[model samples]
Target: MKAIFSWLNKPYYFNPKPLYKLKISIYHGLFIFLFLYIFRPFYLHEFDEIILPYTIGIGITAFVATFLILYLPALIFKDYFSEDNWTIGRNLLLMFVGVTFIGVALWYFGEIYKEPYNLRKINLLQFLSYTFLVSLIPLTFFVFLNEKNIRLRREKKVKEIRELKKVQELNNTEKLTKEVSITSENGKEKISFCIDNLVYVTSQGNYASFFIKKDDKINEKILRVTLAKIIAKLEKYPTIIRCHKSYIVNTNYITDISGNARGYLLKSKVIEIDIPVSRSFSKQSLLRLIS
Candidate 1:
């Protein structure tokens, strides 16, 4: 039971690629069509009197319903459906909602074809229950496939970061000798330091705070500048990269990285606090830190 709960809360992928969506939709439609033909539920066999039309109608309706349920909201709510916060439970919810919608569509279409010749037919509720039952296999299959994909991606990324860390460690010797300069937004205040001395930069509202490592101690220098404004200037120093909306960090100063599914938490040797690599920027930040 504990393991099941952990799996439910584990991170999962959503809003798959367009080609994958289309392929899945097609398979769903075909599965529905095949199930209908084999089971002949709700007097569908009687519809064999005019089988061609009903067959086409069922196939097309299933295809369109699956496509809309799976693809439309992804485009509309692109930012809301990020992989960082998506969980297995959320994905299951999405699948259940999709199955419900597909059931509703099929119920509506089946109503149209219910002829006076045969008044014997299942009600909407029963049809929907049937849909849910029929849908279980495919949804479960996808959950496993998607989880495997995430595991594969994480493994490859971890390997890439490991190799890059080795190269950067060697290059960091020269990087420590260079000096970096940053100025305030109004151009009134400025600070300069050797690359090794700077630990991280954080901003709140319009004030940016620079955390500097000196004599094995952490010191802070504040400047009246937004993080966005200061970030461009810091780019000249390759080790300094923005990891989140509120923070920029020197990758060379990062002592440990926690690979949480939501984001990467960075711990620095000189700084006591944990810096975050946000969902929106984690991929790019990792790329920057690695290369």
Candidate 2:
């Protein structure tokens, strides 16, 4: 049973449109009408007594009416049949019940219509058997089409996520290899390091302190350069993000984050100091840190 209805497990059939339901009903009705007209099944005795046109008319009318009426339940209870929650066995049982109900109703209609004398002779069991057989073909097609649509959508989303991960990895690799050089205002002092090792930078008036990791130890170097100038030079590296007016942190080294009434504090495993994250940049800072 699982192998038989594996296709119906797709999410695409969960919330079908009213128009799509109508189309399915119409298509099923047409198939039923055509099959009965060609085969002239022994259970439907009216085809023997009545002319071809009247037989065709009655068959078309019965199928169209039955489909339209039965479709209401499918539409109303769609959530119960959704892929996230539905089971194949339960779905088949429900469909069987619906088809049986439709057959019984049609059989009653045949009993009431006295003009078609032969239709009144159809037994309840025979009518139900024919209805179930006709319903199976169309329902199978519906499930197959829905499953195909869902599989395509899932594949597309997975491909997009893979491409996005690849792009992020490339950017991270470039940032790790790229070296940045900071020079003093007088051009007499210079500091150079790879963007990946730089943990954070702090501004104190005319001096900018660089915090970096060397041989698994945190080290600091003071430069006679403005924080604004250093920030401008490091703009190309997205991991080296600004967290506060006076502090900029490398998101790569962020070990933990905490928030308080004052603001957020970012801690790095490489460094002993806790870096302040200002209120204005707190939300974005945390997002970058995690990403």
Candidate number achieving the greatest lDDT relative to the actual structure: 1
Model 1 scores worst on lDDT over the 10 consecutive residues at 282-291
Q: For residues 43-77, write the lDDT of model 2, one tens digit per residue.
A: 55454655365545555665566565546666687
User: Across residues 165-278, which tens digit of lDDT does each residue of candidate 1 receive?
Assistant: 666645555655677777877778888888777788898667988888888888899988888877787777778788888898888777656554444567766678877676
Q: What is candidate 2's TM-score against the reference?
A: 0.44
Which portions of model 2 show Cα errors greater than 4 Å?
A: 1-12, 43-71, 74-90, 114-120, 137-291
**CA lDDT scores, all candidates in order:** 0.75, 0.65
What candidate 1 gets wrong by more than 4 Å, as runs, is: 16-27, 30-43, 71-80, 116-120, 160-169, 176-230, 242-248, 255-291
lDDT of 2 at 172: 47
Q: What is the model-wide C-alpha lDDT for candidate 1?
A: 0.75
**Residue pairs with clashing backbones, model 1:** none
